[model samples]
Target chain A: MKIGILGSGNMGSSLGLLWAEQGHEVFFGGRTTEKGRAVAALAEQGTQGGTNDEAARFGDVLLYTIRGINPAEVLTSVEVLSGKIIIDCNNFEIPEGFAYAPIELSLAEKLASQVPNARVVKAFNTMAQEVFELAPSPLKDYQVSVFVCADDAQARQTVMKLAEDIGFTAVDCGELRHSRLVEGLGNFIRFMIIGQLQNPYTTLSIDVLPAASEQRLGGRQP
Target chain B: MKIGILGSGNMGSSLGLLWAEQGHEVFFGGRTTEKGRAVAALAEQGTQGGTNDEAARFGDVLLYTIRGINPAEVLTSVEVLSGKIIIDCNNFEIPEGFAYAPIELSLAEKLASQVPNARVVKAFNTMAQEVFELAPSPLKDYQVSVFVCADDAQARQTVMKLAEDIGFTAVDCGELRHSRLVEGLGNFIRFMIIGQLQNPYTTLSIDVLPAASEQRLGGRQP
Candidate 1:
C-alpha cells in the first residue's frame, strides 16, 4: 500500500516509519516540506517526504494525522482525494482536559463530509503514538485493540489489514457514525492513561471471555 | 452495608442478587412493590422488596438502575439521599441507535445535581447484567475492567471495593465529570457486542500491557 501521512508530528512520524519498515511505500507530509523531510529521513530507505498536497497525491491510502486544527483547512490544499482510502486518526483538541466532540458528528465523520468522494475510516486514534514506536509488534503478550469505523466496508477492511500487519487487533466498529463512540472511547482511554494511570505507554484492549453457557456446556453438546 | 436497587430490570435484579449473596442487606425497589417483590423472591433469604422510597430510605448505598425515564422523576420520589453513596448505572436512551449524552452534562453528572447531597459514583454501566450472572467469579482467566468515577474519594473507593468484591478489576477513573467518557464507553461496548459481534455475552477491559522500556529492561533495574 502506498501510504501518505498528513502530519510530521509524533503520530504521523511513528506510523509512517512502521509502515515503511513493513515494506509499505510511506510518504510523510507536513505543513512545511523540511518538517516532513526530517521525519522521512528517520524512516526506511526509499520513503518520501513533501508538502501535504504532494503526499495526498502520492498515496492510494492517506493517514490523516494532523491534529489541533480543522481538517478542512489542510484537506482543501490538496487537489484530488477522490476514491482514496483515508484512515482518519485525528481527534478533537482537549484544551480544558476534556474532549468535546462536535454536536452531531465526530471528527472522522466531519472529515468524511469534507472529502465526500474519499473513503474515510476512523482508526489509530485510540492509542498513543508511543505504542507505534515501541516495536513492530508492541504488546507481545496481549493485543491492543484498534477500533475501525467506516461506511466503506472495503476501506475498513483494508485499514484493518494494515493495522493487523503492524500486529494490532483491529476491531470492526461498524459505520462512520459510530466514530462518535470510538472518538469517545479515545477520550476515555486518554483520561484513563494520562489522568488516572499517569502513564502514556499504556494501551487498552477488548477481552471477550467465554459466555456462562459456553463454559457450562464445555464438554456437552449444545 | 445496606444496598438499595431503584429498578427491578435486568441490571437491577442481577446486581441486587449478587450483593444479597455477598451478605449485604439487599432491598429491591421498583415502581410497584410487587415488581420488586418478584425479583427479591428469587434472591437469598432476608432480602426485602418494596417501593422506591422505602428502598431509598433503607440503604446507605443505593444502586440507581432505572432506564428510559428521567432519573429526576424517580429520584424525586425518595425523601432523602443525603450523604449516601449513589452508584449511578443509568445510561441515556439510544432510541435512534446512538447513545446521546445531555448537551452540557452526562447522565451521571445530571444525577449528581438532582440530589446534591448524594455522592454520585458511576460504575456497572459499562457491562451487561449477564456478566454478574455468569458466576461470582466470571471471566476467571481475564479481569473484566469496571471503570468507576466519583467526585467523593471515599465514595469512589467504596464503589471500587464493591466492584472488586464481585471479582472485577475496578479502575478508578477519577471525578464524576469524567463519567461522560465512561458513559460513551458504555455505548461503545453496547454497539460492539450487539451491533457488531451479535453477542450479548461479550465484555471490554483496559489491558495496560508492559511498556517498551519495561520490556527492554527485563530482569534489570529501570
Candidate 2:
C-alpha cells in the first residue's frame, strides 16, 4: 500500500518510518524538504521525500499531521486528495497542549468540507507521540487501541488496516460527527496522565477491557 | 460515615444500597417519600428515607444524582451544605441519553458554585447502572475503575475511599474543573458501547491498562 504523510513532524515521521518498514511505499511531505528527506531516509528503503502537493498526489492513502484551526490553507494546493482515503491524525491544541477546537464543528468535519471528495477518517489523533515510539505498544500484553471514525465504512476499514499494520487494535468508534468525543477522550487521557495522575509516558495505553466471557470486535487480550 | 443520596432515582438508589451494605448510614432523598423508602427498604438496615432537605441536613457526605440546569432550585431549601464533602455523580444528559452539558461549565462546577461551601467531588457519573448493580463488576478479573476529581485533596480522598467501599478502583483524575473531561469520557464510552460499537453492558467496563513494569497509582491488574 502507498502511504503519504503530510507535515513530517514527530507523528508523521514516526508513522511513515513504521509503514515503510512494513514494506509500504511511504512518502514524507513537508515545507522543509531536507527534514522530509531525512525522515524518509530513516526508513532504509521503499520511501520517498517530496513537497506537500507531490506527496498528496503520490499515495492511495494520505495521512495528515498538521495542527491549526484553518485546514483549507494547508490543503489548498493538494489537488489529488479527492476520492482518496485520508486519515486525519491532526488535532487542535491550546496553549496547555490539550486538544480543543473552538469551532462548532470538529477538525475532521471541517477537513471533510474542505476536501469534499476525500474519504476522511479520524484515527491515531488520540495517541501521543511517545506511545508511537514504543514500537508494539507494550501495555498489559494487550494491543493498544486506535479508534477510527468516518462516514464511509470502506474508508474506515482501510484506515483500520493501516492502524493494524502499525500493531494497534483498531476499533470503529462511529461517524465523523463523533470526532468531538474522540478528541475529548484524547484530552481526558492527556489530563489524566500528565495533568493529574502524573503517570509517565510508559505507563498508559488505551486498552479496552471486555467483561468476563463477553466477545468484542477487537481481539480480546488476556 | 453517613451518606445522604439526593434524587433517589436509579443511580442514587443503587449507590445508596451499596454503601448501606458496606455499613454506612445511608439516606435516600426524593420528592416522593414512598419511592425513596422503597429503595431504602431494599438494603434491609442502615438506611432511611427522607425529603430533599432532610437528607441534605442528615449526612456528613452528600451525593447528588439529580440532572438539571438549575441546581439552586433544588438546593435552595437546604440550610447547611457548607463544610461538607459533596459527591457529585450527576451528569447532564440530552434526549439521546448521552452525557452532555451544552454549557460553559460542567455540572460539578456549577454545583460547586451554587453550594459555595461544599467540596464537590465528581465520581461514578461515568459508570452505567448495570456495572454498579454487578456485585463485583466482573471485567477481565480487574475491578472497574471510577475516576474522581475535586479541588479539595482531603475531600477527593474521602470520595475515593467511598468508591473503594463499593468495589471500584477509584482513580483521582485531578481538580474539579477536569470534570468536563470525565463527562466527555462518559459520552465517548457511551457512544462506543451503545451508539456505535453496540457492545452490551455485560461486555464493557472502564479499565486502565498501563505498560508493563511501569509504576501506577491504582493497583495494577495482572
| Best candidate, lDDT | 1
DockQ, model 1, C-alpha based: 0.43
Top candidate on DockQ is 1
In model 2, which regions exceed 4 Å deviation?
A69-76, A96-103, A137-140, A200-222, B69-72, B95-103, B135-140, B200-222
Instruction: Please write out the lDDT profile of model 1 over residues B1-222, one tens digit for every residue.
Output: 899988878888888887787788999999999988888898756899988877888999999886545456876553478899999987666646654543356789888887888899999887887677564554434678889999999999999988877678899888998887888788778877777887776677887766666775231111
The DockQ scores of all candidates, in the order shown, are: 0.43, 0.26
Best prediction by TM-score: 1
Which residue ranges in model 1 land beyond 4 Å of their true spot? A68-77, A99-103, A138-140, A216-222, B68-77, B99-103, B216-222
Which tens-of-lDDT digit does each residue in B1-222 have in candidate 2?
A: 988888888888878887887789998988767877778877767689977667888889988888754446776554578888888887656436443433356789888887787888998876566555453434324455677989999999999998887767778877888787777666666666666655535222333445434534332222
> All candidates' TM-scores?
0.90, 0.85
lDDT of 1 by residue, A70-89 (tens): 55688655446889998888
Q: Candidate 1 deviates by what RMSD?
A: 3.4
The fraction of correct interface contacts reproduced by each prediction comes to 0.50, 0.19
Q: State the local distance difference test value for candidate 2.
A: 0.71
Expressed as tens digits, the lDDT of each residue in A113-144 for candidate 2 is 87888899998876566655554434324456
- In CAPRI terms, where does candidate 2 land? acceptable
